[model samples]
Target chain A: MNNHENTAIEFNQVSRHFGEVKAVDSVDLTIQDGEFFTLLGPSGSGKTTCLRMIAGFDHPTSGQIKLHGRDVTNLPAYDREVNTVFQDYALFPHMSVGENIGYGLMIRKVPKSERNRQVRAMLELVQLPGLEHRKPSQLSGGQRQRVALARALINKPKVLLLDEPLGALDLKLRQQMQVELKSIQHEVGITFIFVTHDQEEALTMSDRIAVFDMGRIVQTGTPSELYERPRTSFVASFVGTSNILSGETAQKITGSAQNISVRPEKIRLVAPETETADSFCAADGQVTAVVYAGMITRYTVALAHGQTMIVAEQNLDDVSKSVATSRGKQVRLIWPCSANNVLQDPE
Target chain B: MHYKNNHRPKTPKGLLLSAIGVLLFLHLPFAIVMLYAFTTDETTFTFPPPGLTTKWFGVAMGRPDLWAALGLSLKVASIATVFALLLGTLAAAAVSRSKFFGRESISFLLVLPIALPGIVTGIALRSMMGLVNIPFSFWTIVIGHATFCVVVVYNNAIARFRRMGDSQIAASMDLGADGFQTFRYIVLPNLLTALVAGGMLAFALSFDEVIVTTFTAGQQSTLPIWIFSQLTRPRDRPVTNVVAFLVVTITAVPILLAHHLSQRDNL
Candidate 1:
């Protein structure tokens, strides 16, 4: 671990319960001073519950949450030094954008002249300087999102929490905002705790991601670690698409080979007639289906042991000329022994 | 099953007869009173052979008793409406949004006075005030009207609060605002329209209320009570008609305005 003393936020075994249901169970995490950390999971997976606890909207049933080494476990939301951007952008419909952005400073009892200056600067930062007079209903979805960010950032809190902030945008706009959010975080240099159910969003925007299952975190790692070295089957299936195969672990056939896992893109297909006998980790299978995407082709192959494996090949050149016709025919799959990742089965 | 497949009559003749029956059931008494108000004869109900005159309108306007009653009714309604708006909104916010023991029971009891019969509430309040040894005055009448009027405001405020998601309040609190600041900046603006609509409705209901007002109000004559007393004495019949017409205009205008404001907010 890096010996950085600048820890912005930490949760020490925090748990929350509603009636008999434990919504969040024993979560422990540390967010660095200027890092963008994401809590990624599906619905009812405790990701939002964790984010709310950090924001002080929900108090933990047990354990504690600390901000800059101060215990804020039972602080009211208004007493905490954090701000949030909601999923629907939650802009005040009655106020103009200028008023909405300046609301936090006004509540802090800052002088009007200084508040106006900071509001203008934050508006310019979001690229919405001239549109301050418009109401939230008058703006497009993306513009409203930027105003929400500006409103939360104007307070200059110790940390910022965002709850599914881009869940309402279209796919194209969501991708564009992903870049904008990351760049804005870098520019502001404040710790950000973001919650999102979209796996791709977490992978794209976060410095590190904590993957949550039902009420507990399954894994937490950097993007590359999560993709290439998943320690559990849940992480492998959740981080990205993977075709799972179940079989008894055999003796190592190659150096350092235990149980084998091959990524879909790494697997190669060869025609049955021209197949060599020395192909590495070769498996014979019948082609069940072929899906033709524009940049790649995916084949669903059924092995002799009734396990289906998916293989994807990029179309570097004309795919028709590179391989013989094998849409319905049996084929052989091969991959390097080093490409397989061994992960423990899920409980 | 046979009832489900029976041929229902779709002719305009059947619909027209039902519509006329409903109209007659609702308006027959008002039509009779209006016809009698214009008659020149000083005797019991007679349909024909009576000349019409605008002289009674002038005489009704000249009476001091009617004007006094009208003034007292306006004061009571205004005071009751303001008190109901303040207390009702606070009660709604506390009961609807907070979690504590007996919260459901408190909400249920708050609406009980309005749900029960008006006479039952009036009698109950009369005995309660007597036990406390508080004499009936203008304040008593205002309190009586406000007890029921509060239900209207509380109901409207609670519904609006529910429709507005809790995220707006959370966002405001997160943005360095204290609890009161969040209430002022975020919660109050959203609640303004609902309160105005509910206030106007409460005012209208209090203005026309006579059943409970009759028991709680010992000597003060509100417009409805004044009209009721005038119905017993024949010399004041024409003035009662004039007062009734004016009451309809006063109550209808605020209700219509409140309806328009609520519809605008919905859009």
Candidate 2:
């Protein structure tokens, strides 16, 4: 981990309250320089509020926010060295694309000639050359998003804050823009603090993801770590599809493994009469239902104890031949001991 | 789909009749004024004038008293419009965007003059000016006009400001521009059309104001006051019609122009 001194943004026990409701509660986080950090949460989880505070749009009710070791807790938004791409893009409809991109430079009192040059370069950088004369109303959703990005990046801010920037786009366009945004961030080499409720988007773009719940950070880690070793049930369910089984800790099999969390894909299905004894732990059940997805077959198995378990099988050749025939039949479900992930119970 | 189809209007004639009625209600008075402006008769209005002539235009333009009154009205309206635009925009920005105490009450007071009847406001202003011992002059007329005119500008400016998302301001500030710089480069440009429309509307309102102007102008005669005085004089009948016609044209042009500008903004 990078030291706190080298961090681009550091929130020291920051808290914000809106009337009696705590929107952000004592969050302490360090975003490293030139890294893509994401705050992921459900609606009203306070991710956007935290982003607003960092952008200087909202001041924390208590605690400090430091940018490059300088306290900026009280600074107004315009005084901060950061720019934001809002969810709606919020491009000025009255101004042409060039004027929108040139606004920051004009505000900084850059000479007209230099501002024009920089604006032209940024237009080309966003692959939107010759769109200078077009108003925002004339542009498509993706084009307007590009113009917004260009407008923000033209100033080369120390930190770029994106509040659900791709939320307004169609799914296909959003996926494409996510790649473009990640590449753009890489090229600019600025710290990006992104906020989104989309888990797939966070997983695809962030160097580290912070999961928020009810105004507090529940967990923070890399995409793989968050998915494979989610510390809590909320993180596990939020990040990916997981079939949760309510079971007490049966026993501590070893010092390192305290609880069991088996991924569906890890379980192997076998006919009850043809099971290998030493290959895995066994659970016997009747197939309650079978569903055929494009890439996989999902099965709901009912155990004798009335517990239901979900098992997913990759449809390598023919899904019909592999799992379709087992519907309404008793079967043995098996998985290696290593397939289970042990997680601490959330308080 | 079936429900929507069943409820669809069956009588296109009814729709046409209502549309025509609304159009006539809106434009009939203006059309009458335009028709009478060219009348050659001196005593009373007739549907078809004896003959169309520019005689009244000539008579109205040739009077020095009428010219002086027009000039004074223009002077007062111009001063009031400028003051209203400045103070109205500032007050709008403060109330619309800032989080401060008494915001709702301040906004309410800003719009109070317009909400009340013109006679009430005029009477109140007359009493206040008398109590303060301030002589009623062009400045007093400007102040009275501005009380209502500010509401026009404030409504326009505040509506535009609220429609503007906060992100645009944040983005500009984040790019290293100060508050003034952000407003100048980002905010003002967005607000320009609305401000112009509001100013034009305020100018129209101030230019044609009679009830408030009468109470505020102690000795000075604005164009409306001049026209009101001429209504009682038999010798000045044609001239009064001409001046009234001119006042309507002047006021109507700015208001129409402002409407066109605001419509374009919506588009």
Candidate 3:
């Protein structure tokens, strides 16, 4: 009942059940206009199901789905003013790239000349110009991904849903596409609801993200907020690597009984003689394992009170040699008390 | 030197010989049939087909009854193939694209006509026609052939539908296409090659079918039935061989073409 002018999509306690299984449990969500929002979760966490419902490919078992304040719970996908870039690309195999990109306009009864012009423009916008004559099967994986993007974008939908469209690309191509996708969203100024299981991809591109677990949104926040102040243990562990300190171990460090989470990168390695400052929390431990990644090294420290914490340190200057050789050595791990994000127990 | 050795031909001699033996066993009978179509001697079995004159081919071509039967067989196969393609594709789409009660059982029933003995299907169709007082004619023959042809197309169409997946259809809809437009643009194009291959296979199946056609066609003769009757005559033996060769060619072309189309899809 709030003003819906700026709300691109609103799910009013939506739930989708497949007979006995609750694929998407009852959830309330709102996506603002022109925001690059992401639904992030592991497989079967209902991220894709949420995107499908928004696209009208799926219907909610209960509750209402509103698009720009209009009820579209029973509207078919074609009637909705939304388009999707599917994970498999789903390019029409028989059509050339030009035809695939122009299919939407053609369906809408656009003239052939105008449709072709728009297809060309879209192809260029996706950075895949002059390859329109080739069929989808003739293109490489990355090219096909671009073609799918162009095809959906040509329709000029009010909102665009991307369901792991970059999942099929190689590492280098995927990273490149991430930056390109963010720029495209900015250029179009269209509301984007992207679904991805890769939390890093969600963090790198999305303006805001909803972390889902077990058919429910565990948390929704900006990337920095979710990374810095994860409200639940699932959110703390899923969004990024966190050293979840709780129970007696948390009491010993923070003098509090509540569960807290500290990120691996937030903890610093210091000399054993270093004293804990009033504004900082410190734990005495022995370095048990060292993992040397290219840009960073992670150390597993077994605290004296019997819990283990992982500390990630950048391989900068002499820190790399020292941390790589720190196994079996006594160390003091300290971080600002502000870094200890208190968590509510996951239900 | 090492590279050349690694690249050396590695086909085993015994395996090659056995493969050649199997190929000859399967094809040598057809080669003899071809040779006898040009045999000069009639009503006699002779080694090497004494004096291959090509006279039987001319005689076989001149028969008005043979032409009538060939024309009828082609008409029946064409109509049956069309029926099979339509019904089979619809059945395939329903089974593959929807979730409903008894979907699996429906799929199992679709292929039952091809699985059961042809004589059993023939008898069943004949009895049903009798019970309904429906006259046996060209239409009955087409219907009988379609019963099994539908299975051929369904098998091909269903396999392709499953492999092609439903994502394309969903993509089509998400791109602002209604049900008809989605099928016309997305589903139909993706399904074209499969349907063509299936239709070709169905045509071949209906062309040479004998048992079912016999029960369905009352007072009518298709090419296979004509060949069956010609086999009883001793004087027209070489002529029958010529007609059989023509039938073999006609059926083999579509079957081979369908096989080639399907094989290309794998690449």
Top candidate (TM-score): 3
Chain A TM-score (model 1)? 0.92
Q: Rank the candidates by TM-score, best first.
A: 3, 2, 1
lDDT of 3 by residue, A192-308 (tens): 999999999999998999999989998999999999999999999999899998889999989997999999998999999797779999999999999988788899999998999
Error (Å) of candidate 1 at residue A84 is 1.1
Mark the 10 consecutive residues where model 1 chain A has the least summed lDDT.
A248-257
What local lDDT score does residue A161 receive in model 2, on the 0 to 100 scale?
92
Better of 1 and 3 by DockQ: 3
Model 2 clash pairs are none
User: TM-scores of all models?
Assistant: 0.85, 0.88, 0.94
Q: Pick by lDDT: which candidate is best? A: 3
Residue-wise C-alpha lDDT for candidate 2, range A57-91, written one tens digit per residue: 89999999998777899998878888888888878
Worst-scoring 10-residue span by lDDT in model 2 chain A: A248-257
- TM-score of the second chain, each candidate in turn, equals 0.87, 0.91, 0.94
- Mind giving the per-residue lDDT tens digits that candidate 3 earns over B42-128? 897699777878778788878999999999999999999999999999999899988999999999999999989999999999999
Best by DockQ: 3
Docking class of 2: medium
